[model samples]
Each structure stands twice: as structure tokens, then as C-alpha cells.
Target: MTWAAVSARRLARHRLDAPATVGGDPVTRRIADVVAGTCGAHAQVMSAAEVSVAMRVAGAVRGDVRNALWRDRTLVRAHGPRGTVHLMASRELPAWVGALGGLDADRGVAVGEPYLDPDQVAALAEACPGVLAYRDLTATELTQALADTVGGWAAEPVVDAFRDHLPRWRWAQPTLGHRGALCFGPNRGREVTFTSPARLLPGFVPMDGPPALRRLALRYLHGYGPATPAEFARWLGAPRDRCEEVFRELGDSVERVTVAGAGPAFQIAGDPTHHELPRGVRLLPYFDVFGVGCHPRSLLFAGGAARRALARGQAGNYPLLLVDGQVAGVWHQALRGRRLRVTVEPLVRLSEAESDELAFQVQRLAGIQGAEEAEVETGRVTVGPHA
Candidate 1:
């Protein structure tokens, strides 16, 4: 196999689960993947349309939209990898929290802005109910509530007050942001709902050290298997040996395979040929697992692609556009007034055909995201400071 094939195979294996088949129908395979790999984890940020397509392709529609919403797995807020919300697996919560021990504070504030003090943050934690639903609260309302409960401080002031505190735990998620609510509810009637930090805080739970780390290792290998101890350590923010222990426990259940040209590859024992590669277009959200699961860059993108993509610090600030299993460009969308603007920052200049293709894909994505209309634009790409 050539380098591309090897790369594709390794990625497919690490990201995909077992007893599955690919190369059949792209739509069908996609559904099987999102459901199987993440079912125990819970419903992620999949657009309603994507879910619908998968449901139709899989031939498994149990009820109407309302029922489907409820039937969907419970989504929860999680922390790890650059201090952002991730949709995490519920069954895997304990392991995730334990693994994330003490790294919470490193996440920093939004853009590293200093906000929220240790004592005040602790107070917020204490005041926080297990689950909080603002229903529809404006910034003012949220601030008012916080002030009412704690020293009557304003929201921004409250946040700024405790920016120096550090976290006492880490999460064990292979990737982050897959276990949270589907989307942020719009501001409504000065009240909105959200999962309280306390309910999702792993530090609240008592855990044994080694077992917790071991469980985290197993999940990472399961979802992002065929990986080395170094790669696992980078993703989990743990020591390499800790990850090795879990890999050791799995034994020969995992097979060692090398890309035709790429280095050694380890994956669950299964023919990767079973997975299909559809030309379907996807507007992967920021911090998509595919990019976050491995390190050393080579695992996902070509030599420099990973470094470039993540140049904006570890937490990716850009959304990548993938075409035919390669990094085509980076893109983002904004709904301004009545127009939907889709911007593409290409790593390389695009041919007319490539540009047109990108335009079409962006249009479709914008529609799915509930935009009234779409316009496409391209700009020079950059790998700069995350700040």
C-alpha cells in the first residue's frame, strides 16, 4: 500500500469500532460509526439533518422528531484539552474525570482572559446545583443570579475575580466536546438552562488512582486504538508509562500493523477494507475528535499539516475542510444579518474546479446550520500563535 492508503487505514482503524463494515454505502457506514463508537458515550453535536440521514440509511426510526430528541443519548458538559466543552460518553465519565485530575486550571479562561478567583470559583461551585437550566437568561440575568447568591458581584467582575485558580482534576476522554448538550439554546426571556459545573465536575467523585488511569487508557485505545504510548500520553495529558499499562492489559487483542510506508500501526484485529470512503462533505465543528485523537501530527495530516492546523495553540481555533481524505483547507461560517457567509482559508491556492467544489459544499453546510442563504469566500491560510 502507498503512504496515503496506510495513513487512511490507520486513521480509519483508530477512529472506528469493531464488527463493522465500510466501502459499502457511505451514508450507511457513517451512521453505524457515529452510533456505535459513541452510543455508550451519548448523543454528540451531530446536526439534526445528519442524524436524519443516518436514521434513514440505517433503517432505524423509532419515533417522530420529539421522540427522537428524547431517545437520543443524554449529552453532558465535560472539560479537557484547552478548556472547552466536549460531548463525552456518560458511561465513561468516571474514568474521564479521574484522568483529567488537576489540569482544569490549565484550560485558562476564554482566550486566557483573567476571570474568576479561587475562592469565588469555589463559592460558585458550592452554589451550583447539580444541573442548572437558565431556560432563557440574558447576560444581565445570569449576573444578577450570581450576585444574588454570592456578594452581588456582576458576571464579568465575578469571572475576572477568580481567574488565578487552578483545577484539581483531569479528564480521560480520547477526544473532548462529544458529551455535551447538542447546541446552545438561544437567549430567551432572561433565563436559559445549562448543566451546572458541579454535576459535571469529576473532582466531586472519589476514585482510585491506577484503575481510573487504566480505564481511561482502555477507552482511548478502543476509540483511538492502534496508537503508541507517546501518542496516547499526548492526547490524555498523562505519562507515557501510564498509558502503556492499559495497552499491556489489552494484550494481543490488538494487532500490530504498519502503514505500507508509514511507521508501525496498532489497531483492533479487523480488516480495515470493511470501511467505506464516501465523497460526502462534512463541516466538522471546531475541536473535532479526528484531529484531537493523536499527536506528532503524522497520524492525521501529512508531515506539516498537523503542526500548521494546530499552530493556533493546542486548542484548534479553526475548522478544517476535508476533501477526498486530505486536508483541503480551513473554513468557518457566520450568519450576518440576512446573509450567510462561509469563509475558506486554503493552505494552498485552489484551482477553479476545487474552489467551485468548496463553494458548493459550504452552501450545503450553511443550509444545514439553519442559515437562510450562503456565500463563499476564500483567504490565505496561516499557522500562527493560538492567541
Candidate 2:
């Protein structure tokens, strides 16, 4: 089959939903769909994760995301791709757990000679579900419980060994939902807690690894496709050799495509060829999946946008300002009483239409943040780290 040729501009528009205006009847309604679309929503910065979902789902507020996580049991927070905390749908937890569990296992081996021996790690892992089986407990509480149940070593914060594993051995695993053992519970006071997914999301079944990795790779392509195996590996924090193995298994299900001005890439066989570039301006939250998910940094952040939007080669340090589907500037929001002050530092001058669209997006942002009013200030052209 002849490979389809796509432009970076069209890819951005398609991935970011550029043409769609805000405040419509929501292109995505369910919180699960929102999580699935971008593979998983980045939740390292909790507020940014909520805004990322709110931007796609109509009539969704930060509270809706909270309810889905804590009340509805539709979404669960887990350590996902790239070893980052992400909001994943409850139903999809099995596949994610399978794939990420494999990766974590590989990681454990690569790190070599665990602070706790195999038997000790195994013992702590075995004890974790029992300690957190029915009820949720904060990190401190969980740590103490593990120490009480497992021993003094479980309580020690083994920084070099892996900080995430300190509280409980199961925490070291990729998915807490694997045995329906745990899910992120509501924050108790200022501390986050974990509860049993079995209680929260009944009928949870973990899938096998091969099929789960296939599903994960497909979802990654669905949102950030026309990509390379190396890129996928980087995104998943898995070894490139492993990614290549999975891609080979995919076979003709994915096709090699040539991107204009870029080399070879791969996309799902039947993905849409025609995509409309988004118009006007959009405000993308810090760690917005669109900005972080796409690979070949050169293609997405070309025209010096990378220098302006990224800090020290790290994306998501600042929120992005998109003008016609391209990273044109960076923005920051501050709340003063009932009003939100949104300051934009553009890399290029904005046209009147773009400016108008920016103001509209600001209002939409204010609504998402629960601010009654907003003030948008577009400043002088400034690029790079300072911007």
C-alpha cells in the first residue's frame, strides 16, 4: 500500500482539535473517553490535568473530574506511561497495568540489586494489599502500616532504591488496579490516600501482556501517530528493542507514512488523511498531552517555538499559547479575587482575529477555573527561557 503523506500542520490540528471552538456541546462527554483519547491524561500537576480534560469535554469543570475520580469510580489515578502519574479510565486499567507492569519489571531488573532483596521485596508486595485492602490510607499512614506489618525496612525511605516504592511495595508496581488491590482515594486533609479498586470498581480483570501492549501502542498512535518506534519507546519509557518487537507484531495493522519535510513515520492503517488546521488561538495547560505526547521534537516545536515554550529541553514547564495550531507563545494565569489575570508572552505578533480568539479562550479558561472575570494581557515579543 502506498503510504499517505501528511503535513505537520495537519497533524497538529488533528491531534489538538484545533478548529473546534470552546463552549460547544462537548466533543467528548465521558471522563473515561477523555482519558482514553490522549492515551492517558497527565496528572503530575493535578490542576493541569483537570483543565486538559475540561478543554475537550463540554460542560466539564474541575469538580467533574474530581467526581469521576472519587465519586463516580469511572477514572483512577495510577502511575502510567513514562513512569508518570496519570488519570486512566477504570475499565482500561487492566491493559495499562499489564503493559506498564512489564515495563516496571524491566526497570527493576535494569536498576539491579534492589535495596531489599527479592524475598524482601516479595514480602512487602504481598503485605501491601492486606494493609490497604478495604480502606484508604495516606502516604504517612500507609508507610507506618507497612512498617508495622512488614518490618522496619518497609518504613525506611530508600531514596536510591526508588522513592515511589518507599510507602508500600505494591506502589512500586505500575498499576495499583492489577489485583483490584488499590486506587487513589480522596485526599484526607492535605494528604492523598489509596483504597481498594475492588471496592471502588467491581469486575476489574487484568489482561495479558502481549494484547495489552498492542492496545497501548494502538492508542498511542491514535492520539500521537505517524510516529516512530523509538518515539513510542521514549514515550512509554520502555526499551526501544521491546517497542520494535511490539511494532513488528502489529505488522500491517500500521502503515509507514512520509511526513512533509520529515522522514518516515507510522500511523494506523485507516486513519483519516484530511484534517483541518485549527484557527485562531488556544491556551494549552502545562503538560497538556498534545504538547507532551507528540514526538520528533523538531517537527512539533519547529520555528523556534521549542526554545520559547520549553525550558532546558523540558516541555510542560509553562502553558502554551497556540495561534492557528502552532505554539506561538507561552502564558501564565494568576487569580486575584474574582478575576483571573492571564499574561501572554508571544513569540510572534498576533493578528486581530487571533487576538479576539485569545480573549475568548481566556474567558473559557476563567470559567474552567471558576473565576467570574478574566483579564488578558499580551506583552512584547519575547522568546526562549525568559519567555
Candidate 3:
């Protein structure tokens, strides 16, 4: 198949070809639907995640995402795929934990130093659920509690990410989540807190290893299939050989296909979805899941888009303007109280219809952010990546 067909299918899977209606679904369910459909959202910037969920639905706003996350608890903040902050639908999180435990099993992923032994890491992971069970603890409080629960080694400031040294347990927090122990609790004041999924969900249990990994592979193929194991590894932040092994285990469950630009790839054995032309104009925010997950970067960010939309070959750093399922430009938005000003710098001139769609996308953005007024200017976006 051609790259165009692949892009179209991916867009349709993401519900980006057209806005999907929630119908009579409540706000929480709507948010979870979008989150699960996108395979989880890049939520380093909480507002970006809210926009990511809101933009895919017919009528959702940022406030709805918060209500789902905190009020209804339909969605939970987890350190998910790629060890980044993601807003995952609560129900699907166990499959992620079960499938994604491959990374958690690797003690070297966090650090391969003697200061943090695999046994110590295991102890910390075991201690998390009990300490955090039915309670919320800020980073500082959690680390101290963990140290008290496990050993003083859990609190030693050995791992360094920020200017100050952080405890190994803190550095390996994401892995703990995959172990079915850690998840983000609501913020206490300005500080972030961690909670146990066991307490959050009624009966949270990590699925069995091999089958869960297969489920994850199937999910990946469904959303971003006709992709290679290496691409899957890149997306999962796991070893390529391990991913290739998963594909091998699946055997005939997936069908191998030759994508024109992407070379040999695989999709679920019997994909019946129709691939139509992905025609639309979408304004995607920073760390949008689609921009980050699409494979064969050379095709997605073709020609000038590579230089304009990406930062050092990394996706999700710049907001993207998609035209006909391709990166057509870069965009930025500034919210000033009730007003939202959007600036788009397109690599190609948008047709009248696409221009209208872009305006509608701007309106969607304004609605999601609860801005009273919206403005757009199609010109050079004078900002660098992530600005």
C-alpha cells in the first residue's frame, strides 16, 4: 500500500478525518473514549492533553477532561507508554501494565548502577501500593514513606535528572506504575502526588505477561499498523529484539505487508477498515499522541516539514498543522484570558475549503479552552519548537 493509504487509515483510526460524536455518552465517557481511541494522550502539559481529547470529539471542552480525571475518575493519570505522562482510560490501563511490564522487568532501563540494585528496585515496587494505597502522597512524602517502608536505600539521592539528586524510587516511579502500583493522584496545592491503582480501581491486577504483550501489539497495529517491530519498539521505548519476538509469537495472527515508503510491515491479519483519502485541516497541540506515534518519520514530516515541524528529528515538540493527513505547517496558540490567538505558518497554501476547516479547528480550540473570543492569523509563526 502507498503512504497516502496508510495516513488515511491512521487518521480514520484516530477519529481525525472528522470529529466523532459522543452521542448521548456522558462527558467522562467521551473523554475516556477519545483517550482510549488515541491509545492514551501525551499529557506532560495537562492542557495539551485536554486539547488532544477535546479536538477529536464533536463537542468536548477542557473542563470535561478535568471532570473525567478528578470528578468522575473515569480516566487516571499514569506514567504510561514511553515512560511519559499519559492520561489513560482507567479500564484499559491494566492491559498496558501487563503488556508494558517488559520494560519494567529491565532494571537497566532506569539505571545500571550498583547503587540501585534490581532487588532494591523490586522491593520499592512492592512497597508502593501498600504505602500509597487509599491515600495520596506528594513526591517528597512518598519517597520518605517508601524509604521507611522498604529501606533507607529507597530514599538515597543517587539518580539525578533535575539539578538536585532524586531518590532511585523517584527516578523509577514510572516503572512502578507499570508494576501496578503507582499512578498520579490529584495535586495537593502545587505539588503532584502518587497513588496506588489497586485502591483507585476496584480490583486492579496486571494481566499475564505474554498474552498482554500480544494484546498491546494488536492495539498498536490497529492504530499505527503496517509498521515494523523496530517502530513499535521506538513507540514503546522497549528493545527492538523483544518487539520482534512478540511479532514472531503472534505468527499468523498478523499479516505482513509491503508499504511503499515504509518497507516490510505488519497489521492485524484481517483488517476490514476502508482506507479513504485523509482530507482535512487539523491544528494539533504540543505532544499530541498522533504526531508522536506515526511511524517512518521521513514520510510524516516530508520535505520542509522535517525542518519546520520537528526539533532534532523528535516529534511532539512543535504543534502541527495537518493538511490532507500530512504535516503542512506549524502553528502556535496564545491564550489571553477570554481570548485565544492562533498563528499558523503553512508550507503550502490551503485551499478555500481547507481554510474553512482550519477556521473550524480554531473554533474547536477556543471552545475546548473555554475562551470567549478566537482569532487566527495565517502567516509566519515566529516561535521555535515548544514555544
Candidate 4:
């Protein structure tokens, strides 16, 4: 078969392998399967933070709270993948984080924007002792508490300013609801709302060196398999050679398949089943890995179409509505009276049937996210629990 047909088939298979895919197993095993099945039995790695959060949410053997550091002995950490952090299995860190360059300068892409400069970060570390709960510490409280150690820097406004570097900042609250909301929780209303990094860092699985690289390649390949080195590099924010190295290491473990409609793609030896076209719509979170993973997103959407929709910042900044496995529109949600209202913004004009079909999908998403009901408005769609 021609490459396009081969790629299309691979794309279909990829849709089948995605985590939390619809109609899949409904057990903790499914979650574990998502992490393990994507790579292999030996490939159970995730960011320490991501793992901690995942475990807390999943209610693994330990209680939801995490500790200050995952590995108590290590003073230095080998963060991996895109210069950000991941909780790889202990065995995976040396090969993953150690192989790549350390502490990337492009904090926005890697470490994130509001990253604390050395002094400030150090101050944060030192202040951890005085910190009671993760509740939002006013910059003043943080500043006064750390004044001796941090020197002249003012702490109050600095805290607010820090937000520019770290948009996800929130004081750990005493209630579980606060903590869950800060992170992505399956359902709402738990206790221990405010959280500190300490509460979620231990679960970090650090993978360093070549093993890290190989694991990343395997994850990307399995999750987005049937892709080329270029595609993998773009998603990884790394070089093509690095991507190829990982693929080479795996060798025959990954099955290389050429797609017909989609061109060339790859797939794991055995993936779970998937749905046919019109599989249903998904409202993906902003900066969702899917969007950033594949640059020149035409690989998934219509060619030249992704950049236009994504460039808008506002529309591109929020959760997206994916219809039929393609990012067809953008959506937002707000609570209204007794229901949730959802606004849908289509990148392209839609026919009457298409609009109606999209509205139905938005309603479903609202229900899943805990809205009582849903309403759709024109121009832009907003999803809320009230009318």
C-alpha cells in the first residue's frame, strides 16, 4: 500500500492507544496499563511530580499527601524531557535526564516561565521549613519569613511577580478541594485543598541518561507511533539524532508500519482496540501535550490549519474541542445559575448539522466535568453549569 494509506491506518491505531481512551478498561489497572502499556513492562517512568500527583489522585497505597523530595539522599536532581521534570522509575533516570543537556535556558518551554531565579528559588527552598500549609502565602508572609536568608529581596509583591514565572502557583489550602482543583482531579470536593511542592514531589520518577532518552522515544512512539524522527524531535524539543538513537536502541521492539492515507507511521506490537470515525469529541486542556507534541499539526488537523487557530493566544490558550479525532473547535466553560454554559468557536464555518453535532459534544463534556447542565452560545461557545 502507498505511504498515505499506511499512515492513515497508523493514525487509526494511535487513536486506539491513547490514555484514558473511551470504552477502555475502567480500573486502576487501566491507569497503570496506560503508563506501562505505552512503553513496556520495564518502561514504567513518569516525572516525579507527575507521578506524585497521579498517585495522590489515584489514592495509591499511600495517603494522598506527597513528601518534599522523592529521593531523600540526592541533593541534585536530574530532571528530564524538554528540560521540565518527570517522575521516571528510579532505574530510568540516569539514561534519561543525564544524557540530555542540563537545566535548559528556555525556561518557558522547559522549566516554565515563572521559574525562580537561583536566589529566589533558594529562598523558596529555605522557607519550606516555616511553611505551615500550602495555602497561598502572601508575598509579605513569605518575604518576612525568609528575610534573613534571602537578603534584600522583598517577598510580598515578589510572590505575585513569581506568578509570571509560574502560572500554576497556588497556596496550598487546608481543604482537599483546593489541592485537587490546583491539579487535574477526576472528580471534585476532597480535603487538604492547599498543597506544597513537598506534597507532590516524591512521586516523581526520575530517569536519567540514555535510558531516559530511550524511554521517551518509546512513549512517544507508542502513544504517537508510526511517526518519523522529525515528528518525535519536535514533540520532544530535542534533536533528530537523539530521536533516532532511541528508535535504534529499541530496534524491532517497535513495529514500523507505512500508512496509506496518512503516509508512514509506526505502532506497538499489540495495542488495544479503537472506535471508528465520529468517535466523539474531546475537550482537551490547554498546552495539552497533543498540541505541542506535533508541530505543523497538519499531521493531525488539516494542513496549515493548526497555526491559524493556535496563534490566537486566547482561543489557543484554553481547552480545545476535538471532533472526530481532529481539533475542530475551541471551547470555554463558566458556571451559570443552575447549569454550565459552553461556548464553541469553530475555526472554520460549520453547516447546521455540524453545529448541532458539536453542541451535543460540548454538553457531554460539561456533564463529565461536573456541570449540572450545559448551554451553547454562538460566536464562541462557553461551557458552564448554569444557564
lDDT of 2 by residue, 116-165 (tens): 55566556556766887778898777778878987887666664433443
Which candidate has the top score in lDDT?
3
Model 4 residue 316 CA deviation in Å: 5.1
Question: For every candidate structure, what is the RMSD over all alpha carbons to the true structure, in angstroms?
Answer: 8.2, 4.0, 1.7, 9.8
Look at candidate 1 and tell me the lDDT of residue 173. Answer: 16
Candidate 4 deviation (Cα RMSD): 9.8
Model 4 gets an lDDT of 0.42
**Higher-scoring candidate on lDDT, 1 or 2:** 2
Any runs in candidate 4 off by more than 4 Å, and if so which? 1-205, 255-278, 312-318, 347-359, 378-387
Across 233-328, the per-residue lDDT of candidate 1 in tens digits comes to 777655566566667766776677665545675666563543344232334445556545643355356645565566543534456665545555
Rank candidates, lDDT, best first: 3, 2, 1, 4
Off by over 4 Å in 3: 106-115, 273-275
> Model 4 misses residue 87 by how many Å?
10
lDDT of each: 0.45, 0.72, 0.86, 0.42
Candidate 3's residue-wise lDDT over 138-240, tens digit each?
Answer: 9999989988998887888987776888887776677777878789988899999889888888788888877888888888898888889999999988888
